[model samples]
Target: MQKKSCGFFSRASELQRAPFINLPLHTGRAPAYLVRRMIRMSHAMSKVIIDEYGQVEFLRRLSDPLWFQAFGCVLGFDWHSSGVTTVVSGVLKQALKLDVHGISIAGGKGKKSTSAKTDILLLAENFGLSSAKIDSLLYANRMAAKVDTAAVQDGYSLYHHVILFDKCGNWAVVQQGMNAENGMARRYHWFSDNVQNFVREPHTGIISEKKNPCALDMTAAQSQENQKVCVDLAKSDTNNLKSSVYRLAARDTLDRWLGGDMVVDVVNTSGYEMPRRLDWALFKRIYDVQPGSYEELLSIPGVGGATVRALSLIAELIYGAKASWSDPVKYSFAHGGKDGVPYPIARKVYDESIRYLYGAIEGAEIEREERTDALKKLASFTTRMFPGQ
Candidate 1:
């Protein structure tokens, strides 16, 4: 994913307020018969949403992590498994015909995900998109992946990425990352209409049940100073940065530097350790480029999580500009219930989504029995979500 700057929406506050939902990793392919039904259902529902609300609104809804999860449930996928992201996205890619829906999906699971740029090129030809607009779309796709994988170091290695976009250039991203050790997956969401900055708290939502207490979140607002310091360090003499890194590494622990006699145990040191070695070649390239902003620094071809971590540590210990170690996950597990365990459900909005989805299912051209089964599943999902409601 090559990087380029693109205009993003300036609704930071609204994006920050969006809800997140989790899905645990599950093995095995979804049955073929079930996938057929999901495709049909997704097509019908997507048509209804686009027809009634326009393509932009459809993108917005898909960007909502909660609604996306609920949509997967309504379409008969496992409501709490990681497959919801890949399956639902794959179904939509097949379901939404560009000529009919004015929307297209690019990228997918595993190896398929790497062809997003090629897919976007072919798909956008039908829409008569300009080269610049197409580049922006690609930039959005790459930067979202970069931010999630590099800027937010939560230990989830991304494997699935898809970008849903309309002829108008608006887009949303649904990508899933897995932590092989824990057998859990995290989903990241991005909407072109909800993001103003790519580097600072730009996600529409992030869904994960497990929160890494020591995750490095350079995207946090609190990390703004550290980001600046990182850029400055990257622009400064590489030898000076190297010396600082050596000094920090020479010390057995950063306990004194961090301003406390805190225990220098394995767990704590693991979070703050200077990388055993820095990529001097990459640093030399960064120096030559002299990136003016953290976003640009991240956009550099070779910069990844470990490099970002090393820079963040140097920024903190040497410059005293602390990077936030807090996990950016806003909610955990299922969407919040009525009593607000993780957070209160926005009932009116939730009901509106349910009503529209139900109406679409009722209006769909599928067989009566299939329709009945889908509605039953939707109802079962609702009951599980809010018991006794």
Candidate 2:
């Protein structure tokens, strides 16, 4: 079935609101003046920046295609809550155009309680790595079995740094650990511990020792039975939900998002100008807010300059949502939208974001020189992305 969009913004009091408002279209391309401004900024910031290869490597791996799909399965590890697995599945269908099945492993556990680092490696092992080696690694750590043979065999990939916002609790839910040394036995640290900083306790559901294959292997008819068991398990409703049910709910929520059934209010709005968190010299830009562009959006309660720039870029590049005002393209977030979806972008949110980002940048590890340079690059990219308007 052709999936549908999710429903984050259309609920409750906002039901009367259009799920999405028009993000008006702007005309023309980037201006030479803005380009020149960026160049000047870059020159001013021609010093103070360092590059770390490890950080880049981590970012690159987490962005891997296969890793994301496997992440969905390992997290839920089942049939019903297959949204995470399916995001990749859908993309794969378009790219490779191949029909693929992703198993899920979900139960009633909060994001904080799930250990993706341990679980992903477990899945990797199940794909073919020797459990004897895995077992030895676990034994050496004196860790208990929170992973079973079935889980290892069933899931193999994972995602890192996915952020989830909880409106009710007002907390950020994220997969906190993605250490490379996690799955490797030889590279295991002898005296140090990563688990202490891991977002949560190691999962306790998976049995370390292999049990009867018949019971452990929940496939086809058995998979159906497992689903039923999970449903019934939820009805029992104890202090702790079986891992399966929690996995189901979390996946369902995320799926609703993937399917566009739910709307996620992007916290990161139009980053009208470049981010100055890095040293200007390294990034080679000193681009600050474009006169009225960033401040106009930043004046909003939650909107930040970055969000403005981002929204502008997306509006121009993907949706063509424009900002308002005859103000030069350099002076506007974009051509304003009739309904003001992304353009004119939310004023309340934008300003708040700038204040937040400024603090964040101050705390960031970047030289002023590098920071200015990076901003210039961002401005250049933004200008190029919008071209002719």
Candidate 3:
């Protein structure tokens, strides 16, 4: 995950939208030789960072998309590959000396992601974090994943998720989603420091190479009024909400709402259609809770993409409140590329990352030969990254 400069989509709007470049997924694993050294170098580098700046600062850096990308480059991974998100996080989970550093990472790709809560529990126990604080951390982890996958639909399905935190409870989430049809990946980032609301523009950064057409961003600040409408619908009578959902689901009603012919043409070409079923039971739970905010409404169990989208459309049709359908991504992720999908490798940024790590490794208490070998490996990487330079 990386942050592109704001120049790609300069806007003075209050939202301060970040660019997300779609990363086309490239196959193959990080080589064993590289993985081994990555763990060693990453462990050494992370120790140096934490010792100098403290735990919160270390997590803050990890949360920055560009810094995380540079970290991957320093570890010899493809600088622009989606694997950087997973492999770098995996290495950190395995390499970080948590007992010494007082920080830990939990969750990962595929089946590993399911164990995030348990991992959080174990880490909390290790840090002696209170049950309430542990519960809050777990909720943050779950909601971040949910909001990205369910609330923000950009045609990508999340396949990897990770959360990093320290004993003091400052935390960050880095997760990636894949659009298998196009082989493109998008990574969403969350930092506790920037999250004032779990559902409203909570992401510290969102990265993709291209903006997804017709994608819905319920988290955008533009959706604030729509979010309120959706909450009001949730608190309204379940019977009326069901009737509204059914009307929106019906093809005839859609044709009427879309002004007839345009609806069919658009739906036929873009495969854009409203959800057929609404979870009325979920609506009942929402009504029972009578959530005061959209974030609280979204936090309820079983309130997923369909539920959110249905309410958004109904809110638009009945109350004339429109949610932002514009995708948050303006362009691709930052720095450079491995295959140069967006542009050639960013030589300066890559070189600087190597120099920083080289200095850190040299200053560590590791063997002198080890430090020399690390620098040699980095030099070789630099040569490969830019043959002429």
Candidate 4:
């Protein structure tokens, strides 16, 4: 089912209003000329946004998937291109110098991501944030990446991650992952303000060009039951969970447990057959720690996708607590829909977004026509996304 959704781009119902990572595929680097221009325009834009709305508002808009996409488009990048994420983040890193803007972007594509902790430390020192606060922010960055990469088994391996924050400690994350087979990339966004539970519904938005039907979304609200069961199973004796995995390894036992009618869907969606054996060693370690919640279980090292999936299945099949198999795709933009499928667009909210972007361009060093053209592009993007009444 995940393969079906991922193999092609498809529209989901607009009413669901769930967050999803934007997944789009376009390779190669943006031309040097374009990149340089983006950096200049983005820098000007950031200054205006921060000046008008304050720093927190700037971070909030960046955390928004639709606003982020539109910002990239306004800077002249392809609207649906995967490079939008990498280029926008990269340009921001270069353009938004902390001393000048009071906000800093740490980390980058691939190997650069490893420097996030170091960068955060330096920024923390400059900002005069205490060790506790800095450590907390650092932990937030690590856990956010870990949950997306390992907890969500959506077949995308994260290669690009960046965290943007102000000196006041507010932060947002924009990260992208690539699926080797399909050559598609999915981007995930996180805002510290919006994160209630890191393990469940923690994204500001996820805008993927395609949805994965069988994607194991343990964070889905419907999976709340399964999450509880998984925590219990983790705390229970390792031998019990190991036995269930052993049962899954045997075709006869699996068939008996699933029954004839239920076998196909379970096998296809769960990948029950592929993970032939359990990592009992890791399970023993988990057993020792006995995590009190699903979030903690996910945070533990070695608690990768296979381990999580297996636990979910056992919880569902044996304990009758099922995880959500439904796709959590919501096609929403910055202002939302005027008709109110997800939510009605407020005039004040919409105007404020435009005001900031417009102000940024107006204040930029660009010529009169460039500023006018930039505003026109933003207007067109808004109209196309949400037509007026």
Candidate 5:
């Protein structure tokens, strides 16, 4: 992501009002310029986004929750706030207690769907679209693609997910999502199976607030039925997040980036320092590395087209193994959602989301001080809920 000099939406209307609001931060760390490296790098951001090392230092200062609130204002209170992207980029730092800078970022574009089909010209008959092009389509902004191209500093076609965070300079695929149009559910079998097993076995992690065994009790079987919602969602074809380039990197490459960034300091929270180099071997040992064997890799937890691409790249380039870059899933923006909507955009979820946000903001304003962090965030969300509003 690029660091942008976010000119305030307006100069005089800055006093905490409406969506583009501000807060009277009693305290804030150094000037944003001081930690220029840590700001969010968006495909659309034209400014010089901070690099990995600079991001680590910037996060150290944001470790204060009060600073978070204060900075939230300085950056504009909108989630789309110029600062929101930057803040989110570093927020994980505070919560995770790790420096993400210096981490290598990587991921692969599984497949591309274009009107054109070209298998005739290429020697090996590679498909028409490259992962990079797919990335352009998905990210639309090209921030990740730019970062990968710039930071890779190498000739080995990045072989993991299209995105990977190279923390400590060691690139590893920690989490990856598939993009193939049809196989995601089947590919995520590892997760599905494990969760299934977890439910079948004794689970101490989920504690109920029950006073009596029979008090408002649901049979274990029935409770498992309710838990199946997540399982069902995991398999859901509706607006799934599996193909997101960012999500793929966040999941697969998060550990690699976690350590290099000094994450905890970024969020002002106390937690273990993000580990140095997650054990990719752990995954490797448990799962077979059938490079380009999308069907096999998809069965592993956290494995997706991105993971397959990363592994295949490593296997082929680094280890001298050959693999294919065919997209793993069919690309679709709508996924399984209605072409338009079950209800019109002006009437359906859009209206509902706005009403809910407005009511929530109004209620908070009425119940407590009109100016609260909650209200500020609500305002931010509302702007997104109703763009022109």
Candidate 6:
């Protein structure tokens, strides 16, 4: 099969916008009746996708934010709610059978998210993956979470995490973070094939309605020099780093610390603050470990957002290596049809979509060639509708 191009996987232009999907934080569990229908619809849709495109391609589609959002809508979830991420993932987790689909999902919302390692090991053993391959998958899972939570210091804090993988170890990640202040959620997507370096612009796409004016994006390509400096500082003496922090904290004014006459916005100055509470013991441990790269330094246990921010500031202020402070969000959407901007979700239409897809898959089981051609036409139509996806 020929591979199709997806814009999210391309690294040619950093300025090009990624596909967008907004997720507003809404409290409430999806009704049991709605969830049951969603499970059935998700199972049918996933079956056809895996059967037609294979497990790897299915993983690729999940890594695309636009496709994932559409999938959530097709499953009858509120398109603009943060629940779309968690609900869709939860539905897929229950719907996809490893023995049937040759794929498995691990981790989930809140406390369930912490059990990913255990789930991965169990599922990998079932898949007969080698010890080394399983270990690599585990590392990938950990690093994906770490990169989003620390390296990219957007205000959102991750609350939901799930990794979808196939028998061959190809994987996709859909994790979401919440901004408690604004009550919005941002989602991060990752595909194994698209990532070459975990520390540099590694996300396939990041989706959010609100973009922070001054996010500390350490994973940005422009931050490469700063990343190198950060690694060097981590390997350097803790005393020198502490002295730099002290000097930064002792400054009387923001302009003096910034070394300019420029006025600083009081609200956004939180991003620029030199963290007064530095973990000197953690720094000592980091110094002992002597991580050769920023990624390695980040993978070290206990390196949270605070540590990453402090390091970036120190690198910029004292070492003359400036990190990028641009928010990494690619695009935004304010409303969803389900939210009654245009119209509410029509149950009859939604049910018809599910029935049509389910019936088509059942028909394909009997008339594979004709169904395949029809599916090709559908794909062509979708390409025309969503070009560059």
What's the TM-score of each model vs. the native? 0.88, 0.20, 0.80, 0.85, 0.23, 0.79
Where's the lowest-lDDT run of ten residues in candidate 1? 1-10
lDDT of the structure predicted as candidate 6: 0.74
Q: Which model scores highest in TM-score?
A: 1
- Model 5, poorest ten-residue lDDT window? 185-194
Between prediction 1 and prediction 6, which has the larger TM-score?
1
User: Tens digit of lDDT per residue, candidate 1, span 1-389?
Assistant: 11111111123342333332346788899999989989988888888777877899889878777668888998899888999999999999999988778999999999999999899999889899999999999899999989988899888999999999999899999999999998889889888977888998888777776667688899999999999999999999888877676566565454333222221111124446444445677888999999989999999998988789888987897679999998887542234444553356656655765786787788877888988988998888777656645
- lDDT per residue for candidate 5 within 167-266, as digits (tens), equals 2212111112221332121000011111222223211111111111111111133333332332232333322312222233443433333442112111
Which TM-score value belongs to model 4?
0.85
**lDDT of the candidates, in the order given:** 0.79, 0.25, 0.73, 0.75, 0.26, 0.74
Give the per-residue lDDT of model 4 (tens digit) for 1-389. Answer: 00001112255764234222344677689999989988888888888778777788888888777778889978988777889899999999999977668998889998998789888988778788877778878988998898887667777888999998877789999898888877788778888988889988788767666667577778888899999999998888976766665464453434423323212122322353334335667888899999988999998988887778878888887678988776554443445455654455556756765666777888877877768888888887676665763
Deviation of model 6 at 152, angstroms: 0.8
Per-residue error for 355 in candidate 2, Å, reads 3.3
Evaluated at residue 66, the lDDT of candidate 6 is 57
TM-score of 1: 0.88
Instruction: Rank candidates by TM-score, best first.
Output: 1, 4, 3, 6, 5, 2
Q: Over the stretch 255-366, how does candidate 3's per-residue lDDT look in tens digits? A: 4223321121111112445664555566777899999998888888888887887788778766778778888753322445344534666656555455556666676666
Candidate achieving higher lDDT, 1 or 5: 1
Per-candidate clashes come to 0, 94, 10, 10, 61, 0
Off by over 4 Å in 3: 1-22, 246-272, 330-389
Give lDDT: candidate 3, residue 17: 28
Best model per lDDT: 1
**lDDT score of residue 351 within candidate 1:** 74
RMSD of each: 7.6, 26.4, 6.9, 6.4, 23.9, 8.9
Better of 4 and 6 by TM-score: 4
